[model samples]
Target: MTVALMWEARAVAGRGADLLAWARAQHLAGTPLRRETFRAPQDRVLVITWWDAAYDADLPELPEPDGTLVGRPVHRWRFEAVD
Candidate 1:
């Protein structure tokens, strides 16, 4: 099965660039099949990772950024691919 994990976070005021840089620097213990990073208005950052594993399988995820850099807790979700 194919699973896609989504992680999103919002940065504090005037810190969008810093947040984006921090997210890009993170490294997971295991490499995903595919990975991509995105930024949006309101200083939001998103990271999506695709993995060749079961929906419930244990997988590595990006850690939370420093409190000073983010405005709120990160949001995350996982989805299983379907034809």
Candidate 2:
């Protein structure tokens, strides 16, 4: 089964673009089958990556962007397809 990993972060006031740029340059250890990014209200950036790995497998994730650019620590979640 394939799993999707979601990572999200909120940029500091007026720094959303910088945060997005930083995320775009990230390089995870494994190549994802698919990847996407979104911009949300309140200066948030959401990144979802599809990988051919188990939900519980240890995988390399993007490191947090510089503290000055984010309002808080990054959040992450893992999900397996149900359909």
Candidate 3:
């Protein structure tokens, strides 16, 4: 099974760059099949990671940023590939 984990967060005003850099610096305990980072309007940062595991399997995910860096709690989702 292939699973994709999505992590998204909104940085505090004017702290988007800092949040992005912080996110980029994080390291996972296990390597993923693929990983990518992205940004959107409103200082939102999104990271998607693809893994070779069951949808409900335990996986290493990026941790939440410091309170000063983010405006609110981070959001996350999991999806399984479909054919």
Candidate 4:
């Protein structure tokens, strides 16, 4: 079965570029990552990443961000692939 991990977090002021660079490096390192950013009504930045499926036995540990807001939270969701 295939599984996806979804993560969301708030970016620090003027830190989007750095965070994106890190994410790109992670993608190149072999995680099938799709990412995007958007602005909140209050002008804060939100980043979301979708990771491609990996087998439970072969799952890789995700990298952690160096800098971000204190209250920002990350979430993950997993799903099985269907034929």
Per-candidate local distance difference test:
0.97, 0.90, 0.96, 0.49
Per-residue lDDT of model 3, residues 7-83, tens digit only: 99999999999999999999999999999999999999999999999999999999999999999999999999999
The TM-score values for the models, in the order shown, are: 0.98, 0.94, 0.98, 0.49
Tens digits of per-residue lDDT for model 4, 1-83: 45555444445666655554555455434545555645543224444444555545455534556645323544445555669
The count of backbone overlaps in candidate 1 is: 0
Which prediction has the highest lDDT against the true structure? 1
RMSD of each: 0.4, 0.8, 0.4, 4.5
Task: Write model 1 residue lDDT over 3-49, tens digit each, in one string.
Answer: 99999999998899999999999999999999999999999999999
Q: Give residue 81's lDDT in candidate 4 (0 to 100).
A: 61
Candidate 2 residue 6 Cα shift, in angstroms, is 0.4
lDDT, model 2, position 75: 100
What tens-digit string does per-residue lDDT give for candidate 2 at 1-83? 78989999999999989889999889888899999999988889999999888889887787888899999999999999887
Ranked by lDDT from best down, the candidates are 1, 3, 2, 4
TM-score (C-alpha, index-matched) for candidate 2: 0.94
Global lDDT of model 2: 0.90
How far is 46's C-alpha from truth in model 3 (Å)? Answer: 0.2
- On lDDT, the stronger of 2 and 3 is 3
Worst 10 residues of 2 by lDDT: 53-62
